[model samples]
Target chain A: MTATLSRIELMRGLVGMLRDEAVVAGIGNTNFDLYAAGHRSQNFYMLGSMGLAFPIALGVALAQPRRRVIGIEGDGSLLMNLGCLATIAMVAPANLTLVVMDNGVYEITGGQPTASAQRCDFVEVARATGIAHSAWAQDTSDFVRLVQAALERTGPSLIGARIERGPAIAQPPRDPAQIRDRFMQAMGSRKGFGA
Target chain B: MPSDSAWAGVVLAALRKHDVRLAVYVPDKVLIPLIDGVHADPFFTAFTATREEEGVGICAGAWMGGLRSILMMQTSGFGNVPNALASLAVAYQIPVVMLVSERGSLGEVNVGQVWSSRVVAPVCDALGIPHQTIERLEDLAFVVDRSIVQAHATQTPVVLVLSPLLTGGKVFAA
Candidate 1:
């Protein structure tokens, strides 16, 4: 699919579908877009790390088997830790969903071309890695449909949304501890906070 | 109580006492018994990581989810995971407990293993992550428990380097 969808719009759709589900956003634009689209206590934004959203979300999914967990990562960040796809497949937690924003460039780092910009197919890689519910979102509508399916079905789904080059609309809170505390409280894992 | 098996049991008990629910590891000869013990127990989730970085990622994620986790690797494997430790665990202040098997030390036969073992401690020092070497069986309980507790208390990565003298190292073909 030719990637022309706006990352911000897609992120908004993702946020709109969640009630109490947890979201782990990768570093850079993926984190910024999620915070810009909407901030929730359930969201765990990465401020420094790349290629870790999937693993973090996998842990959340594993710990809270009934709660849906979404991992949002950029193509460049995902490339850095591609083994996580295989690890995710190995554990295959049904409550997790992986959403990769593929802009084909490291947008936060001066727009350097990633492997996806050349010949990498993330959906294919995810599928080969054993995540059966892997696909490319054709557009915004398709993205919403896939997300709806992901939420409805018991699957470790991977959705690779090819996005247009752009900047994140806003920045998230800079404090990592505050972000961690709120998310833990939202998940009811931290005692006496939101409990 | 001076045997490797005795010390391994002590380390395992301390981990359980510290509420470590997940054990993420890359296979290593010195860690086999400890890995088996964690896997056999119902209280822990035993994850076999394809790479050391993946183990670090899993531990980081588990910590964020409020489940205590530990990462197990050999000396050489430590070289593969510093970026994740520095960027994800350290920068994000996610406490990580790493149990690394000392290789290339004492009677190590492999040239590569020896060279890499020398760098692990220096690397941990350079990363500014506190590391302790456990050489005697009696030290297992204190070192293991304290490192895990201190990691959570400080919200930073901590390493426990298991010396060849403690674990008997891994017997090599060469």
Candidate 2:
């Protein structure tokens, strides 16, 4: 697997294209990079649960059909719930986008090899799983163009960005309740918790 | 009194009363009517989850997006959900109402269903999720309605089991 993209650079590129799209980042290096790029109340860092970013985003997109939602997951986490890909394809929410940060390793827990370390190309897997619009980001500029197109489109899209693991800038706030509350408020789904 | 199968209708009525619209499920024989009902009803955004944890995540996200949601699965499937329930639903205080078609208990024929059935209650208790078993038709409406309504009010996940006594149980080979 040849890689040249940086995780943070890709994060900046992805986030830079968003206005109010809700981002659900999986519990991995993706979580840290999302917060590091720019913390938005709209960004819900799923900092503890692995493999849920896509499912959660699917739910959000289903509930709010007009609002776009994006989910970022690592190769390890996406591998954990590969079945979710089929589920997302079943509902096929037009407002959902998923970016699998395929570093081929669990870069968080000391860089252990993931099942996707070799012989697993998730873009092909996702395309086979019927995500309709799936592609690989050949470079950072291509990543931006793909994501920007995902935002403007009306189909569920999956972007597989092959990247090299680099220094994680920072971790999202470890407070789960605070993360949920802020994200929900930003979506206008709730008002002033506990009042 | 509602008959064994009519319990699905009873629960569906409660869902409508409470306005719970997002329905994610993987079904068994006992859940056929309810699952079918959800699919037929235009009010629900119903779909089959390929796996239980995926359903849990969807319900939580739907809740966050201001829709009441339910994840329906068999006891066997519940075995796949403790981590998701604990880490995402519980930790984030997202109320994901869970509907379980509990197998492997009284009148159960399959040996495989027993272990998962026996563990569901303990698992919910361990996760600090409120769980209730509906054994009779009389208890059906109240439990289903209150569980859904109160889960949202408290922002907690819940497990509602459909007992064989109420559904007549899935029998072996006709």
Candidate 3:
């Protein structure tokens, strides 16, 4: 049933599943397509930065121990902050999920090849860093299955989903900004921002 | 009343008092005295990092491993490391105390340090991280103690910006 869906479609499906199950309380990223498509899920889009989504998700997960936090990351973005995986592993937050959409290029920056192409395999690096579960997805069906499996497991999980490079999607600015505000509001209540 | 040496003694005491057992630092001309003091203390385990951001990442990992940790670097190093602070430390809510020696301010000489140092506070503020600036040696003990307290309370990174006067005079006694 899932064979016909594209990577984008599968990602939408996974976001829907996570939201419907109430498993994920928040999602965050820098990509507009991911942010716009994730409106229903209320995902946070980090507009100004390149590689902060994973660490923000980590903080959220740690603060709300009862809730799940997912970071929708790009390969280029993840490469910029790869050391975060080791930090995540050391903390071993059970509710954190890092999903890296690997198109092997920095789409936002004019389709340049990222350092990941030559340096290392992100999933294997995650495993080596002590994250409990790490794996890659070749297509939509595999992505759905991997995400579902990761959601059920404990400890930090890194899912590298290989995606086809394409033109950037035209998205409304409102969706991304709204989600960012909502997530910040949620984080602000956690103990420190104003208190 | 504690003199400069006494203040330094209190700064050391607060570190131990807060159970900050792990420290990562990148050498800074201004931080030489404090670094030397930290090295002399057996209660603290200190490692030197190649870059400021590497120290931030290592301290984040150390914190996650049940060790309380801090990072010591210069203001110039801080300018080179927004990626580490915004992505790894802020994102993960890792309670890392960054002891930054402020440069290029009053009596400044380096042009590059002056430019980036000006943006430090605004950048930290925009990221929603907390920071305190200390210019007097007398304020060191209070600032360091509050930093440790706030870091643990929020489980987030905190910065203590030390001016040249507070960190110690730029030129060491010959």
Answer with 2 or 3, whichever has the higher lDDT: 2
Preferred candidate (DockQ higher): 1 or 3? 1
Over the stretch B141-161, how does candidate 1's per-residue lDDT look in tens digits? 988888888899888899899
Residues A62-157 of candidate 2: C-alpha lDDT, one tens digit per residue: 888989999999999999999999888877888999999998788878888888877888888898889879998989999999999988888889
**Per-candidate clashes, comma-separated:** 0, 0, 2
| Model 2 lDDT tens row, B34-125 | 99999999998888888899999998898899888878999999998988988999999999898899799877878888887888988998
Q: Report per-candidate DockQ.
A: 0.61, 0.85, 0.13
TM-score of decoy 2: 0.97
Model 1 lDDT at residue A70: 91
Ten-residue stretch with the least lDDT total in model 3 chain B: B1-10
lDDT of 3 by residue, A62-154 (tens): 545566667777788777777778777876878778887776777766788977666668888898888868888767767778887877778
lDDT of 2 at A116: 80
lDDT of 3 by residue, B54-109 (tens): 56645653454345776888787888667667755666565778888888776676
Candidate 3 similarity to native, TM-score: 0.62
TM-score of chain A of each: 0.97, 0.95, 0.81
Model 3 regions lying over 4 Å from their true place: A1-5, A20-30, A170-179, A186-195, B1-73, B82-99, B102-133, B140-159, B164-174
Ordered from best to worst lDDT, the candidate numbers read 2, 1, 3
